[model samples]
Target: MDFSLFAEEYFDEVLRLLRHLCTIPAPSGEEDERVRFCQEYLAELGIEATLDPAKNLLWTLGAPSQRVTLFMAHTDTVFPRATPLKLADDGTFLRCPGVGDDTANLAVMLACVRCIVEKKLPLHRTLLFAADSCEEGLGNLKGCRQIFADWGDRIDRSISLDCSYRGVYCRSVGSHRYQITAETEGGHSYFAFGNKSAILPLAEITCQIYEIEPPVVGNSKTTYNVGILSGGTSVNTIPQSATMLAEYRSDHRECLAEMETRFAQIFSRAKEACPRLTVERVGDRPCMGEVDPRALDELSHRAAGLIQKYTGICPEFRSGSTDCNIPHSLGIPAIAFGLYDGGGFHTTEEWLRKDSLKPGFCIGLEMILREGEAE
Candidate 1:
């Protein structure tokens, strides 16, 4: 098949969609403007689109059927509400804080739908295209969670376009995020010289957790990190309170469980060392496991072959989590793929390689077509 033909015919429309999505600032929990834009765009394309109560935009092609294939991408970006979005001077890149992270994925999803419609292809199963919300930080995977809660049983296969680059992520790297806090009675350093300090306990606990070797089972390697810490007031006064935000990630669920057990043990030890100290667990995000290995391998092989045939780079397994985690946890066949070459995400320096869009779009379309035919 001549993939370039598909690219040539859809280049203009894809660029137009990318420009429209780049201009909208749809940060997490605030995707109203972007949702409206997508609804109108889908309407123009003659696809039936609706915005659910959770503010997710769902577009369907063809009639509702028992066999359904879902194409998902979050409309929310990591950028702030007032970030000014503009095309760069070079006319090749979109210059904005969150343009590459998710906006690019949203645009690519729209482009794929446009291609399917413009080509007049007959789809056996219903195509569910969603521009979901609440994907970053505490927004949690609420948007996708709702979709699965509402319509999970009907979906035979699903894919999320939130990779921010051209890659196929079939393996799920589950993660557990925790906010740990310790508090103690406050007093001046000189006056409280013999008293237990919250900072001391927190530091000791952190050291113990890090010093322990992370578990390794099969292909999965467990990892832990204390990403954020805060507590002390001044040099002369002992800190009364301290907090550390930590996370554990592994491809295997057993690894996560083992780490969790170790963490609890360390916390308990800290409490024994400092009688005045108190500990609290604040928040967590569950890890995503791999889909059926055979199914995942087949899809990966097909996707990698197509990508190599077009872009000369075979796609590889990714360890990051996305909306796919929600469905993958539900035992649904899901993967996250992207259409741009995004680097330095969540920063002003983030950029997308414009040339990647064309080939990426073709690959996405090919994957959808193959998936629709798969039994």
Candidate 2:
């Protein structure tokens, strides 16, 4: 379908909405303001959006039907509440902390909802619009898990607005995250020169963990990283506690299990070196190995066709761990697609190309319309 007229009329408005959204601090578990903004924004368009206990903002269109399709984008960012979401617009790019990842997609979701309402499109099935929270960091996909837990049976299919606009995620990459801590007696560095420090064991564990070389098989690979490490007080003091946050991701369930087993063994070996080492798993996202559902595959191909038609780029289908992981693991048909061209994910320099917004918005709009027609 031609999207020129729609883009001409709503492109600026969508960017404005996105700028407004980017300025709001909606770090996981603290998305009240963003959720409230979405509720009021949709309410002004005569759509009553509701906020669930999980802090997910949701709205529905058309009459209730057995074939329900959900379109979702996460509202949370890896950045904390104190991190500034400064928007820098130099006419070609909009730079912000989360402009590319979910914020851009979230804007696209809102834009599609608004467009559908404005066009007064004929709807044959239920269309559920969701802005879920807690998809990043320690939040552990709580919002999405809640979405499926509460409405899995009735929902026919779901889509996540995530990753890159250049591809569709057909497989879910599972992950296991943990917080490893080491505690010991604290003393002055001069006096404690011969005693064991918490930092020593943390460093040993991190080194041991990183020493592991992941095996890549077919489409799946096992990988690990230590993302954060913090400890110590004064420079002259031997700190009593040190902690590191580490995680492993793999498309194969067996690989994940094996990695966990290795991690346990590594921790056990580290404890012998420092007696007080402890490992606590904090996050787990299940992988749906190499999904090839015919219906969803058709949907993906249709989306890829639109991407090529509008942007001249052949969209790729790949695996990723996203909010769709929960539903996909539950045997519900789900996939993740991206919005906008950008980079610097999970960093302060995240940005989205200004030119990509319009096409991305159109792609999402069409994807939603097509998914709603699924049999």
Candidate 3:
């Protein structure tokens, strides 16, 4: 399969598909509509597609062996359904919410599969393309978990199309997300000033969480964040309850475990001060598990080589928490690489250059076809 020729012929079709997909409101956990659209689009292209229990769209092409090469692009974005998408195509860039992060990559993945079927490309390995759901905040990679659960045994290796073109992630980052709430006796601000207040304990916990330094183990780094904090019945009333959402992430399992210990101590102290406090674990993402060092290096280098071939740029190798996390944790060699050049991901200002689509598609196609070779 000559991706250069394929891109020259189908570039417009892929771009049009990307633009259309960006307009749809496929927020995390609400990706049914977008997945349905993609399934129908593949149907029109003479490809059969299905939705797993977790709503991951799956399309496969068989070979002699049951072992398969997996290609995945998450379909959901960080934006909500009500986010107003204002597209600005300045004849150089296409700017809009959810346009770059994984939306464009999903379209590119679909396009490559379409090209393979259309060109009657011969295959040595079975190929599976997955457009998955719930990759954004709070959704916690449920889509990918199902993908591995359904087909882990037969998966030879996997590649996730995501992020920007400058970097590719080989190791999976681990994370733990938690929601804490404090309850206490309530009264008017002036009258119940002496009463146990819910806000005080939660406030102290938030401060203490920031006080702990992030862990740095070798090249791996850990980070902490308090994303949402809300409480109080009224401005004038003493708060009866308060709640906070917080998380910690690390590229090393030891660092994640260390943070978990520190977090437990923090919550334990708070619990002693306020017996009514409650803590719930909301999300747990896996770190890279034991795998052959050479296998990991081989997959990462292969993807990076293709990117440099297409774009004339060296790609960075790093670790990240993405859809590849599941496969990587299962000891399968997986890497998440970008299919396009873009920035401002997970924000309304997200954009990608219009002209980079061809090279990006070329790289993605090569990644799909082993060694970029056609028999």
Candidate 4:
């Protein structure tokens, strides 16, 4: 298929839309502004978009049918509400908080809708374009959960355009995140000498947990990390409390369960070693697994081929999580593709490659065309 034609025709509009999207500050749960922008933009393209109670923006095209295909991108960015989303001096890159992490993806979804409407592509299955909210941290995957609860059975497939800069993600690398807190009675460091310190026990527990071997096999990678840690009140005093946040990722559910079991053992050992210590698991995010690798391979290969045709770079497997996890866990066919090259995703130095926007638009257009032909 000749995707360049659409790119050539809509290049200016695509750039404009991307720039506009980068200006909106839609941090995770607070996606009201971004949602409004998408609803209005979709409306301009003659597509009816709706916002759910969770502030997820959904734009529907074609009639609802059994073989419905949902195209999803998150409207929420990783930046906080106060961060300024300003384009930089360099013309090639746009720098801002959350520019590439998701705003670029949102822009690509919008451009796809415009292409579909302008080109009048005949889609056999209903196309549902969604700008999901609350994909980061404590927001959880509420937006996607809502979609699954409402339309999962009728939907045949899902294409999630999330924060990828490399290749396509066909296999679901499931992850479980937990917040652990250890506490003890406060005391003076010198007076409480030889007494168990909460910080020391927490550190020892973390080391023991990391020492446990992961059970994942084959090409799939299984890993664990302690991302955050905090404890201790003063340099001269015995710390009364300590807390650590950790996450484990693997392609196999059993492997994750095994790791969880091992973690419990380690915690119990830590508690036994330090009678004052207490451990608690405060958060959990399920791991995603592919239902059919062959089917996913077929879709990914075709999508990668189209992306390479336009951008001269084939898509790569991304290890990060997204709303695709929801469908992938449920055995639904799904893939998370990137719309642009984004860097420093959750930090102040975040930037979006402007040059990639047009190519991304073409890639998404081609994906939609291909979806219409799926048997």
Candidate 5:
């Protein structure tokens, strides 16, 4: 395909929409505004999009069928509502807090849907487009979980547009996130010199948790991290309570289990020592261990071929945790793709190449067409 000639019609429009979307503050739980924007955007394109009870923006093409291909990108960002968004362009790259992660991909998805509908593209299978919400931290893939729970049996394949750059995530990494707290008697530091402080056991548990060896199975890996910690009142006092938020993820179920057991042991030991420690499992993402490698290879090869045809960039195949994670757990075939070349993800200065928009959109459209074709 002649890349430039192919994307000429939609590239500029995608750019405009991408810039506009980056300005919308949509952190995890607070994605209504962006979802509404997406609905209106699709509505203006002659598509009447609807919202599920979870507020995911959705539309369907082709008649209802038992076989469906779901193409979705999340509307939420890791950045909070109060975070300042700086949409900048020097004619080469677009910079913002979430320019690459999903926002850029969401723009490409919307543009592709518009073009496909306007062009009256042929489709044998039902093609569903969704701008889902609650994909970031602590949202627990709520939107996707709902989707699969409701429509998993009928869907044949699922795809998520996330991160940046051309690649296919072939495996799903499952995870368990938790909040652990420790409490103890409170008193002035001078008077409570021998009393057990809440922070003491919490610190010990943190160290022990970090020291545990991550399990490995074949090429799969398991790792854990303590991302947040807080406690202690004042410098002059022995704090009564403290807490830490931690998580572990792996591509193998057995490894995940081992990590969980290790986590439980650590908590149990801490509680035995301090008698005021508790651990709560707050989030869980199931791992998919039985994905057919041959099938995944076929999808990856197909995606890479289309990307090369449209964008001239070679796509890589890898594994990741995304909305796809939930479906994959249910034995549904799912993969994730990126929109452009970008770095500094989850940071304030994330960006994607300005030139990447066209190819990215083209590739996404090609995949949708190829996937929706008659078998």
Candidate 6:
């Protein structure tokens, strides 16, 4: 599949879109700029793009049908709005904060849709394209959650454009994120040394969480961490409240359940030290429940075949916590594959192959054209 002609025509257009999107500073919940830009851009091409309450922009191609193949690329990056957006293009690579992760993929999706609409290409199934929001950090798949809420029953399959060039995430790694707080009366540090201290209880609970033995089920593994911890107002003041942000993840449903139980027990025990202890479950990305083996295999096989076709790489089938988590939880067949080659995801110095956009467009366009039925 030679996409040189298509790339020649649309590469600059796609690059322009990617640059504009990168500069807009779309960080998870704050994706209004990107949402508006994508909506207006697609609508200008005569595509009816809809912006849902969750900041997800969606449009459908092909005739109306029950069998829909949804293509999703999130519009948000892990970097905060304060992070300066810088690009270093040296002919072969586009180096920037989020030029690769989902930004490049979103640009590719936009270009693909424009090509199809301009050429009036016909497809076998309804192709739903979404530039979704809130896929990183605490956003917790809010965009895909709304997407599935509105169109879950209608979608037969899904392909989320994410990751790198040589992989397909067939299994969903479910996770539970929590924000735990301990509160107690505070006094002068010297005077309240013997009184109930909020920091002590929070620290104890965090240590207990780290002490739990990680469960391993076949290829599935359970892991947990406390990423953020803070509380006291001053060094000399006994902390009135202490808070910690923590999460546990696993690829199996039973492991998640077990971790949930363990978390509850840890929080419960902290009440003895700090009577005003509180726990909040902030995010819950699910693992697969009961999916048909045939459907899973078919979805993975098709995505892997296309990847192998264009990139000449035998794509690895793996597990991840991504936008695909939403559909996999709802029993919808979904596979997440990459649109370009890149590294340093979730960091300030991310980069992507500039030339890979051509083949990526070809791979994505074909996947959309021959979706549900036989290729």
Per-model C-alpha lDDT, please? 0.76, 0.84, 0.87, 0.77, 0.84, 0.86
TM-score of each: 0.90, 0.89, 0.94, 0.90, 0.94, 0.95
Over 1-375, each residue of candidate 5 has an lDDT whose tens digit, in order, gives 343555679888889889999999999878998898888888887889989887688788876577888889999999988899979998898899989998999998888887877878777778888899898878899999878877788787888888765677878889999999988997889977878889988889889987998989898888899998999999999989999999999989899999989998888888899887888988988999566667767776787777777667777777788997887887777888886778778999887898878778777877888877876
Candidate 5 deviant stretches above 4 angstroms: 1-4
What is the per-residue lDDT of model 1 for residues 255-280, given as tens digits with 9 covering 90 to 100? 87898898888877877776655555
Q: What is the lDDT of residue 59 in candidate 2?
A: 85
Error of 6 at 99 (Å): 0.6
Q: Which candidate, 2 or 3, has the higher lDDT? A: 3
Candidate 6's displacement at residue 246, Å, is 1.4
Task: List clashing residue pairs in candidate 6.
Answer: none
Give model 2 RMSD, 1 decimal. 2.7
Model 3 error, position 21 (Å): 1.0
lDDT (10s digit) by residue, model 2, range 180-281: 889999899997787778898888888888888786667677889999999988899998899999999998777787898889899888888887888888
Q: Candidate 4 — which residues are off by over 4 angstroms?
A: 192-196, 271-283
lDDT of 3: 0.87
Q: By lDDT, who's the top model here? A: 3
How would you encode candidate 3's per-residue C-alpha lDDT over 1-375 as one tens digit per residue?
A: 347888888788888889899999988889988999999999998888999988899988746566788888999999988999777889899999989888889988888888888887767767878999988777889998998999899887888889988998988889999999999997998977888889999999999999999878788889999998899999888889999999999888789999999999999999999999999999999887876779889989988988899899899998788987788778898989888898999889999987788889899877777732333
lDDT value for model 2: 0.84
- State each candidate's clash count: 3, 0, 0, 4, 1, 0
Instruction: State how far residue 217 of model 4 sits from its true place (Å).
Output: 2.3
lDDT for model 5 = 0.84
Angstrom error at residue 168, model 4: 0.7
What local lDDT does model 4 show for residue 57? 85
Instruction: Decide which is better by lDDT, 1 or 6.
Output: 6
